[model samples]
Target chain A: MSETAQRRGRGRRPAGEVREGVLRAAADLLLSEGIKAVTFDRVASAAGSSKMTLYKWWPSAGALAAEAYFAHSEHQLEFPDTGDIRADLTAQLRSFVRLLTHEGERTREGTGSVLAGLIGVAQTDPELSAAFSEHYSAPRRALAVAAFEKARDRGQLRAGIDLGILVDQLWGACYNRLLIPDAPLTEDYAVALVNNALDGAAAR
Target chain B: MSETAQRRGRGRRPAGEVREGVLRAAADLLLSEGIKAVTFDRVASAAGSSKMTLYKWWPSAGALAAEAYFAHSEHQLEFPDTGDIRADLTAQLRSFVRLLTHEGERTREGTGSVLAGLIGVAQTDPELSAAFSEHYSAPRRALAVAAFEKARDRGQLRAGIDLGILVDQLWGACYNRLLIPDAPLTEDYAVALVNNALDGAAAR
Candidate 1:
């Protein structure tokens, strides 16, 4: 639903503390043991709580994992919005690549392992899918869209190129690099992508 | 480990028939029940085998899940190389997008879910990475690179754009689309990507 709904529902003041603890434990389990290890029991044990406590809050392992990943990673990512469109976009992307390559190892796993599991879980479970769309997918997507819109406003993007598609192109490279063998997320590669996106490839 | 060595070690006989059986069971479980429902006992029971057999092959549940994913999805992908660089690349990319979007629904959980999870697994686990690379990532990468090379040979590309980085930018879009919540892959988007890669973005 809404951020307010997630922020304030069910219990009183201590709920926030309990939720944070649960998410932390889930993240820990995912990093140390991978996706399969983040069971309700494991999360409960790690959080020094019970399975009921987790289920009451998260509803499923995927939800718990998604929240934990966002909690851990969102802070690490700061979207730069300098007036200069090219410089700002490049800097933000470089930061993202560096984070993916270095600081955000577990976060990457959280997205891929736990969040992916949640998406798969959603395919079979309608309740999980709704939860995922609201809590995990939408917020992250909105941020990227907002960034592109800002870029367009600054006159960096061409008139016809779909912003959504452009975002996909930029992100595809990162995911491909991460998934492929011996694929390094290099500055040269990143620069080429940015340049290509800014100016279309029609032979001059 | 050489393919020859691996094959010779297995002695052209079923070295780990029971283990393979468990993996098959795990694959089935992953397909039917999603990643969350897969269990060691269930896999063993489904395969008409024992937990001991599974343990001998895979150390943990994630490991089992990862292997099951590789076994199921590794064979389904192929990167073709037609003489028409643009058309072949488009066809190949379209196939990949379809897999990521459609088969992704069916096999993603079993394949261990998420673009990031796949990458993380590939990084730490050499066998899994090699399998992922050989079967999925490398072949497509090589195909795309070759397509660009073919285009260059035919004088279709500009003089300065790095082919390696260009391929990454094009394929990167696909990866980014799947990794995040973006629009579904369409034929128009694929064409645009091919056109962009072949010719520099600057207008003629």
Candidate 2:
């Protein structure tokens, strides 16, 4: 029945609209119900489209979930270049923590859970892991790395510094807290992290 | 039938033997077949015990899995006080990365997958999350924190540095890499991370 509808005007929605609708539905389902609930059929029905449309775009539910999460995060997280690397990074971290922990109209409270579910699925699914790292993690890391590079060129960063590890130090702490659930990702914590990373922890 | 067997001398094994056997069986099942196969009955049968014995120890499969993973990790990870904080931390990170990514006799390649599965389960299961944090995470963090505090007292670490944040920066980077499959936790990378965190990322 859905296949016949797919053949007939692709469920009466334009291609771009259908794609957007499907991704939106996928994101909603994933954030609310988790990765397991974002099946093609459920997304298609939620988006008021057909399963054929979802399958045409996403080869599997993992692909759909990856795209959905990427789309959601891309809109929420922006790497700002405000000249002051410290402020820029602290703002970015705060925004990220907000996105992860906040319960708002568009963002759900279970973002960490959704991410954890995806990580679990990605462990077994190489294709999904690649798609997630490429689409979600790489872009974000690239932005931060670029900012650090700019800081280096501006003589703001230490010489011979490995930007990759620096980025890891800044972001890894938050990820650790998120995974452990022991420490809350507060604004103060973000400030302290940026300060501690920028100022050597060794005795002067 | 299993209940009858449980009443009859607790499945014929001593209490400690039964507990150890069940945990060993649970760990094997978790590492071999993933989290879903670590049911109480499955673990009991695999350990040559009965379901009643399994229930007498762990309340749920998540509890059993947590205990199993913890038991496996406790034997592998130890925070050694080698006096030199730098070498100690770098060595610890190397060992941890190995445990996370290496394939060995007791440790398998699927350690990350097992952890990822636990993280996913912990998201929805508060009881499991608490158990995992209290039993696995808190103790480890405390050990690291105590080491850092000792370093501070010895004037090896900078004054006014928050050891908690310091510890977070060190371990968080590794956790982030473990969660994100883009980067491998190389030993050199671990050393660089420790140095960068200690020396600060800003221009010296």
Candidate 3:
């Protein structure tokens, strides 16, 4: 029998339940006390699980933190798809900005800080960096890419436009403002960004 | 007498020399050993200065690190003022990308890692964040903004373009790629990014 099955046969909690509890504990520690506090010992104790379980599942603190962070933020990546490309994109970007700036109601407070913490740790942790890109960044990027491609196919985007670069322009601006915190990510800023890219910034 | 004169009268090295030495040591530690090794004591000893001197001038490790990092990178921010906006902007961005990716001859290897380390720490260190934005980000952003404004006055940019947003798009795209590391930042990417921004992405 698998370790999970053996644990279940021994009348301990199911493997999935234990994983969920551990993740929840990790998330709670991350959100409440920052990334530094979410150590294996603390998480295991908080989740009522063994350190062996966490180690078996996640190889490092960063890996565990990445998974917890992803679970906390997975729902924020839902991009809207209205028929009008401009309006659709504007709304999508506005929502993204709201989330990044912690202005959205659905997102928990301090999400940005938690994310920034993960980003910092991920810089040195190769496994965490790859996991963050795969689980957190790729899906959201795909949503925007899909939207741009759809607009292109429907004859909305100008001919010869590189959709990848276009998406980069749109999202990159938001991420810049978000990361720097020098400027506010207001709704107007979002609208202006989308319009600027769509309607070229050059003088006629 | 000023503080520098008093310190000199007391047989201590001049304030300027002390500050420079400390910064040099901090930069050396940051570049050679990474952020973790740049503690105040380490920097002071490395510079042959005292911890009291480092503490007197910079309030925190992050602040000292920011100043040191900025000093090392200040020359890299000199954007050109060639009349051709596209070419000028492309050259500037290409150089910026090369530095961020640690591909430039002038930029040391592992520069990206140092930068990423600073960014990670800055997320939680408000003093470092402020100092970085003030000493590092603001000046470079101002350079880009000035270029765009000059281009607009010369009829290079299309009318009704928001210069702030345009600059953000240009720099932000590079930053996003830098932070994510999912995409390679090539010279062609720089050229294409500038071209896309200058020319509208909409179907003409």
Candidate 4:
């Protein structure tokens, strides 16, 4: 599984387009089939590429699925910065919840399963874990941290707060629900999580 | 994989002791050898029980592993109620973090890897997921929620706060760190999570 693949076959389309096509195919397989369904042969065949391209491009099926997942739902999960941390946080989390749970779409469900699949496999797959951090979790986390930093500078958040914990309490909780699933990952839960994190649970 | 086995063997110690021995063997296998190593044959051989006994009792390897994990760590993870919510939570969470990271043990890294392995496999293993919520997470959560309810009753916590979210923010954060590994799951982080959660992150 550690064999490195290089560009070999003559390409009719550009490498960028080929890569995007492969990712789209991979994401579709992941969403429709499941995490275990995404294999190099399947993705390569579905994307009209060779196994060499896939091996050369992605380290593992988990890594490819992570990048595919990110490519599929990037714009839908972006954070907003309106100088109001609470409102911005709520909006982003709401959108995120909607995407994860398929809150409003006609489709049966959304990327929640896909994301959960990647995360589950990432536990044992080092390449997938690194790619999950590099492609999905790290960048998403940085966006939220940036918002927290901005809010802190604007006097909305408390000074010298641990922004990393904020991410864990908020997004990590959502991930927990996705995996554990004893509780629903809903818009209301997302909103409450933000409110609860900002306003302490203890009595004032 | 779903064969049922009844108590067929002749005189052994007792069903109770036999079951406990099996659980201990399974837990030891999990901690030492990782999740993939806990196959039915291996556990049966390790515990000196027949594979028929295992298949009859547990739904899957995942289920058996879940039970084993819970049996091993149950006493260590008990939540305390000393009438002081902050101190109690800090103490319990510190113990939990220690066990997970082997923070205070000469025994290499503790149950953190085991628990993370369980969670990761649970994502795909339905039997594991159900048993996870049933024997492990559900009971564990009930203990914490009961503590929260008592505190809420005593005017220590805000009235009508979502105890589930509290679990998510605190323990869920720990689980998130274990899975994601972006941050170290240290006792200090646990303390900060509990404090940040209780006191809220907003500036007054």
Cα error, residue B174 of model 1, in Å, equals 2.8
Rank list by lDDT: 4, 3, 2, 1
Candidate 2: which stretches are off by over 4 Å?
Answer: A1-15, A48-56, A108-110, B1-15, B49-59
lDDT of each: 0.61, 0.78, 0.79, 0.85
Per-residue lDDT of A155-174 in model 2, one digit per residue for the tens?
88987878988777887788
**How high is the TM-score of chain A in each model?**
0.74, 0.83, 0.86, 0.87
Interface RMSD of each: 4.7, 1.8, 1.5, 0.8
- Candidates by DockQ, descending order: 4, 3, 2, 1
The candidate scoring highest on TM-score is 3
Off by over 4 Å in 1: A1-13, A27-37, A74-77, A103-137, A200-203, B1-84, B98-126, B196-204
Q: Tens digits of per-residue lDDT for model 3 on A126-178?
A: 87788889888777777777888888889999767667787679887887776
- Arranged by TM-score with the best first, the candidates are 3, 4, 2, 1
Docking class of 3: medium
CAPRI classification of candidate 4: medium
**Model 1: share of native contacts present?**
0.41
In the order shown, the candidates' DockQ scores are: 0.28, 0.65, 0.66, 0.72
lDDT per residue (tens digit) for residues B112-170 in model 3: 77777777778777888888899888787777888888888898987676788877788
Q: Which scores higher on DockQ, 1 or 3? A: 3
Q: Candidate 4 — which residues are off by over 4 angstroms?
A: A1-17, A74-77, A103-107, B1-18, B48-50, B103-107
